[model samples]
Target: MPDPILPLQADQIGKTYRQGATTIHALRHVSLTVEQGEFVAVMGASGSGKSTLLHAIAGLIDVDAGRVVIAGQDLSLLTDRALTKFRRSRLGIVFQSHNLLPSLSAEDNIRLPAESTENLDQEIDDLLDRLRLSARRNHKPAALSGGEQQRVAIARALICNPAILLADEPTGSLDSVTGAEVCRHLRELVDDQQRSIVMVTHEPHVAMWADRVVVLKDGNNLAEFVTDGRRDPQSLAKEYHQTLEGEVVR
Candidate 1:
């Protein structure tokens, strides 16, 4: 048999931004691979280029060097229109903000990206139920609580049935309790549904939910460690700091 296609493959990706006379490198020779049904978290400080890498994988920004291949298709080989269509079909993205339309109800927001109506109702109902928002389906975003709104956003992201889900600081706006709840739901998706996910977060508490964590610093992948299904937040936090400070941690 041929080699299995991964959910995500980013190879030697480089990104640079030019501001007049200054050029800032956001990513330098960065590479990441996420297997099917794996949950990976990318952790970094504000300027560490973690977000840039995520966006590059989502095809929101072009990388100056290297290639991003999702499933088996290379993003660099697609035209702009093809990229947009492919992204909509193959990638699910969730940001820090819920980004739901205030006027639309929860179910409607989830239905926005849907391309076909065949079994659409059943699919939307299933998503709402899976996210535990079945009761809030008719409610608009303004009426939902922070966690609820975020769940709706997640439901929206999954509506497309994409190959990979990319989340950026998914819990940044919620309280600790609510954040933990969202993280639990994410873990459930991986364990129960075999979803492929790549989450970017700065908090160890959130990163601890993933199967493995990749730490980034100064636009490069600093270190990576497996949670091994048992690493606690406190210990992971310590390991994260040690990795950031250029210390070895096993």
Candidate 2:
């Protein structure tokens, strides 16, 4: 059989910005691939280009060089209109803020991504149950806890049944206990539903939840380590620091 196609492939991506005569390199030859059912975390310090890499893969911004392929479709080749449709149907994104409308109920929030509600009742219902928000389906954002609201956001992202889930600081706003709960749900989505996730998080604890962590430094792919069932956040942090230290000495 042929090798399976990757859920996401980013090759030699580079992006830069200019302010007058100053050139700011946000990313430098960064490449990453996420496999099916795998959870990969991108970790970096501030200004390390982690978020830039995520935005590049999601096609939120254009990369000056390289290409991004999602589920076999090359993002750079698509026209503006086609890219919009492709992104909507192929990628699921969760951000730091729940971004839920205060006026809409949990179910309504999840249904927002649907092109039409007429035929999506069952799909929305199923996603609500899967995300464990069935009971809170009628509640508005203000009526739900932080974790619940985030779960609703996840459900909204999944409603389209996208091939890959891209999250940026997904648990940044939640308490430790609630954040852990949300992480568990993300893990289950990979293990049970065969979903692929690429998350950008600065928190070691959050990165530990992933199967592998990819570290970025100074706009480069610095290192990566497999978690291998190690749940201790400190171990990951130590490894991250050591990787940076090694680079410094080189």
Candidate 3:
């Protein structure tokens, strides 16, 4: 039997931009694959192309070369309308900003992405319970804490039962303790629900929550290391910097 289609496959994707007389290669033949139920974090310094790669994988921007396939469907093959619909159905995106409406309650915010509200009451309730927001379901964004607001964003993303969840600095705005809470919730989503996630973060503690870390440098995939049994953030930081410095990590 043939192998099953992967959740995400970004094949040698490249992107470039021209700044007046200078040419900038934002991404250069960078490839990444995310399997089912895997949590992968991409780390890099400024201008390292990690954000570019995330945008490419999210189908938010078209790559200059290569192709991005999500759940067996090629993004380049879809028209604008079809791509929008496909993205809404198959991809969940969370950003540093919670992006929740200040006037809407937590429950209503999560309901915004549902194509059909038929039989959604239980699902929303389940998500609220799962995210430990059952008591705050009726609270508006202004009434919620930062971590709570971000969790609301996460629930909204999951409302569509997306094939993959793409997060860009999901905990960037919260305090350290609150950020760790959010990360733990994300980790639970992967461990308990078998969700596939790809996140971009510069913090070692944030990246450590992922099952694997992919480091990018100078628009190239520099190295990657599994986080399993790697409990020390200082060690991970050392390895990450070493990788960025063009040194091999044992």
Candidate 4:
């Protein structure tokens, strides 16, 4: 069952960038709520305000109006320093790039963030084992395969034990096979651990792993997939394509 209270909630959020006389409205009254333990995918074409929305939710950029709440705190109310600390403590983010340090070994990369803390050594080790990186522990990023590198990235994200996981185009840089594998791993995390995940992507297969899928355009959420949580991810992809075509013809 979906959670009653939202782990992530955005209420009429808005963002505007000023380029001289022109004001770029990246997000227009965007509002969304991701329940605790729910897996949700945000899907949209390029320039559809997908990245901007993630940034706003992550507190990378302050919203011009409205409010964003994560783990029960209103982000707009926090000071810059407090917000930074809050993000580091409670938020988990994964980008398309593996972003592993060139000199760091796979194990080190996964357990890397633990270096900042005195306690978390055991937690880091457990995550390394969970991601199946114990075998390639000493291998550097350059020596690891694409899938391995992404797994290391996932380990890094989980090492923090964040309240909510946010991924932006996580599989965009991988091949079809590797992307599917990444999705498989994510599904396991959501199901086995009951982790809350909100991924931003244009791929339907990626969205299928999610319990619910949200479609966005021009910073506004369009329609949503609210059923068939048991359906295959590939079928969800096909339906998303059909929805796109139907919108185009209208």
Maximum-lDDT candidate: 1
* Model 1 ranges with Cα > 4 A deviation: none
Task: State the TM-score for model 2.
Answer: 0.95
- lDDT-wise, the better of 1 and 3 is 1
The best-first sequence of candidates by TM-score reads 1, 3, 2, 4
Q: Candidate 3 lDDT, tens digit per residue, 1-250? A: 9998899999999999999999999999999999998999999998899889999998999899999999999999999899999999999999999999888999999999999887799999999999999999999999999999999999999999999999999989999899999988989999999999999999998888999999988888888988885657898898888888879664
Candidate 1 residue-wise lDDT, 126-173, digit = tens: 988888999999999999999999999888889889999999999999
Cα lDDT for residue 141, candidate 1: 93
Error of 2 at 43 (Å): 0.3
Q: List TM-score per model, in order.
A: 0.98, 0.95, 0.97, 0.90
Model 4 stretches with alpha carbons more than 4 Å out: 1-5, 115-119, 230-234, 241-250
State the lDDT at 236 in candidate 1.
92
Q: What is the Cα-based lDDT of residue 185 in candidate 3?
A: 90
lDDT tens string, model 4, 1-250?
A: 9656668998998888889999988888988888777888899899778889898999999899899999888988999999998887788888999899989898777776653666577777777677777788889999988888898888888877788888999999999899988888888898889889889999876777788877787777776775367547667876676666665322
lDDT of each: 0.93, 0.92, 0.93, 0.83
Clashes of 3: 0
